[model samples]
Target: MNSTLSNNPAVVIGIDLAKTHCDVVGYDKNQKIVLKLPRISKEKLLERLTNMPRATVLMEACGGSHSFIRKVKALGHDGRLVNPGDVKRIRCGHQKNNMLDAAYIAWAWYIPGISFVAPKTQAQQDLQSLQRIYQGYMKTRIEFGNRIHALLLEYGLSSPQTSRFIAEQLPEFIETHTKDLTPLAEEALLMLRDSWLEASEWEKKAGQKYDELVRANEDSKRLMTIPGIGPKCAGALLTHCGEASRFRDSRQFAASLGLVPRQNSTGDRDTLGHITKRGPKHPRSMLVQGASALMIMADRLEGALGEWVRKIKASGKKYGVKVCAIAAKLALFCDTKDPTRTVNKKPTSAVTKVSGIFG
Candidate 1:
C-alpha cells in the first residue's frame, strides 16, 4: 500500500471487493487513474484505507459489500455503492477486468444525478437476518404444503389447497386413512404431516421473534399504527429504512421501494408503466400482501372505500391491478404519515380500521 495517496489529498477509490482479495483503483479529482493495485487481503485493504486520511470509496452493492461499506464508513470515509448496471454500461477502450471496473466506479461516484445507497445500521442488519430466516422457513413451508396437496391428489383425495387446510385437515386425513394406505405410503404421509407441523411451528416462532423486535422499536410501533402495516411489515421497514431522515420526503422513500409508477414522455406523449421494483423486495411484498388482506376484509363490509374499490374493479381492470394500486397508496400513506395522502377522500371501512384494532 502507498502512503502518498493515504494522506489528505482528495482521492476517489473504486474497490472490486471479493471474499479474500480486493482490487483497488485510486483517482484524483480530475478523473486520472493514478494507482491500480492487485488483490489484497481484507486486513491489508483495511490498513490501507484506514491509513488514508479520507476519500470517497465506491463498490458494487453485493453480498460482501454491505459489511464492507459499514467498515469503510467507520474509518471516516465516504463509501458508496455504484449500481452494477450503471457501471456495466461505461467500459470504453479498456479491458473488462477488476482494475478497470474499479476505476469506472471511482469515476461514476461523482457523476450527476447518481444516487448512493444508504448504509444499514447494525440493528437493521440484525432485523434483516431474522427476516431472512423467517422468510426461508415460510418459503420452505409453502413448498411443504404444496407437496402435501400433490401427494393427496395421487390418492384421489384432492382438497382445496391452502396453508390452513394443510395444517388442520392433512393430518386428520392421514390418520383416518392409515388402515387403507400401504405401509410405505402411510409412513410417507406421516412424515409429511410432521413436516407441515414443523413448518407451522417455525412460522409461529418467526412471527413471535419478529414481533419482539418490532415492539422494541418505538418508530416501528408508530408505523404499525398505520393501516395495512403489521408487525412484520413495520419491522422490515424500520430495519430496511437505514435513515428515514435521509429521505427528503416520503415520496422519495416510496420511489426507492419502486412503489411509484414509471413514466415515459416524448413530445407531448406521456405513458406511465408499472412500478420499478427497484429496492428491497421484502417491504414491497409485505405491503402488497397487507393491502390485499385489507381489501378482502373491507369487501365483506359495505363501506365507502370498499364500494369505490368495487367500482374500480367493475370498471374491467383485473383484481390484482386494483390490489396493486391500493398497495402503492398504502405504502405512500404509511411513509408520509399524512392522512391527506390517501387517494380516496371517502370514509374508512370497518375492516380497514382492523389494523388499528390490533392495538
Candidate 2:
C-alpha cells in the first residue's frame, strides 16, 4: 500500500464514508500517511478538522457527503466530493482497500481537469422537497388520465386522449350514459371520474406553488430569461444548482447535469455515444424537457443560433436530432459567458410564434 501520507508538509484527508461510521486517511504533500483512523462520528470529525491548522478534506459524492460538506465549509476548510467513477478509473494498482480509496480521492482532487460536485445548501434541500412533491402529483395526474382513457375505450365512447379534453368531456359523457351503462362499468366510470377530479386539484395546487416559487426568486427569473425555460424548469434548476458561479462554464454545468454525449475513440477511429447520464437525475430530466419545449416554441428564443436550429428542422431533418441540438445549446446558454463573445439577436420567421414563452 502507499505509505507516503505521514511525512509531507501540506496535509490532505481522504474519508471513506458509510452510514454509521467513516474511515479517514490523512496524507502529507509528499504522499506519506500521517494518520489512518477507524470509524468516527460526524460530530467528532468536524471537531478534529476544526482543531487542525487547516487542510483539504476529500470524500466520494454520496448521500451522506452533503451534510458533512456543509459542516466542513463552516469549519473554514475545503471539502471536496470526488466522483466515485473518476476515482475508480484513477487507481494504479490491484491492491484496493478503504485507506487507498480515501487517499486516491484526495489525490484526484489535487489533479487538474477532474471536476468536483458542489454541495447543496439548506435552501436547495427545501426546494428539492417541494419539486419532488409536485412531480409526484403530476405522475398521479398522468395515471388518472390513462385509467380514464382505458375505461372510455371499453365502452364504445371515445374522445381525444389528452388531459384537458378528457377532463372537459368526463362529466357530460357520464351524465348521458348513466342509465345505459351496466352496474360494473358504471362503478369503474365513477372511480375514474373521482380520480380525474382529484388529479385536477393536485395539478392546480402544484402549479400555484410552482408559479409562486418562480416569481419569488431572482435566479429563477434570470434562468427564465433564457429561451424555452418555463416556470417549472427555471424554479427546479435555480433550486438545484444553488450556486451557478460554482460551475466553471455552461458545458461543465451541462455535463454535471448529464446533457453532453459521451465519447470513446481510438487512433484514426472515433465513436460518439449517448449522454453519460451520471449526475443528478431530476434536474437533468427537467432541462431536457425544457429543451423540448424550447424546440417546439422556437420563435420565443432570440438568437441566430436558435434561428439556424429552426432552419435545420424546416429542412426536414429528424425531430430527435433537432431536440438533442437544442438541449446542447441550452447547456451553453445557462453558462456564464465573456461579454465580448456574447451578442443579442432576435428569432427569425422560420419558426411559429408562441405566446408567454421563456428561454
Give the candidate number with the greatest lDDT. Answer: 1
> Per-residue alpha-carbon lDDT of model 1 for 88-133, expressed as tens digits?
7666556788777877888887678887777777788889888888
Which candidate leads in TM-score?
1
For candidate 2, the TM-score is 0.75
lDDT of each: 0.74, 0.71
| Per-residue lDDT of candidate 2, residues 1-359 (tens digit) | 22323444447888888888777888776666687766776667777777775788889988878888888878888887888888888786557887678778877866888887777787677677678778887888788888877877777777678766766776677778776667788778768768877977987897788788677876666566656667877766766575677776667777777777788999988887777886777776777787687667767646675676577567675676667667766656653554222314533321212111111
- TM-scores for all predictions: 0.83, 0.75
After superposition, the stretches of candidate 1 with alpha carbons farther than 4 Å from their true spots are 1-10, 91-95, 163-172, 175-180, 299-316, 334-359
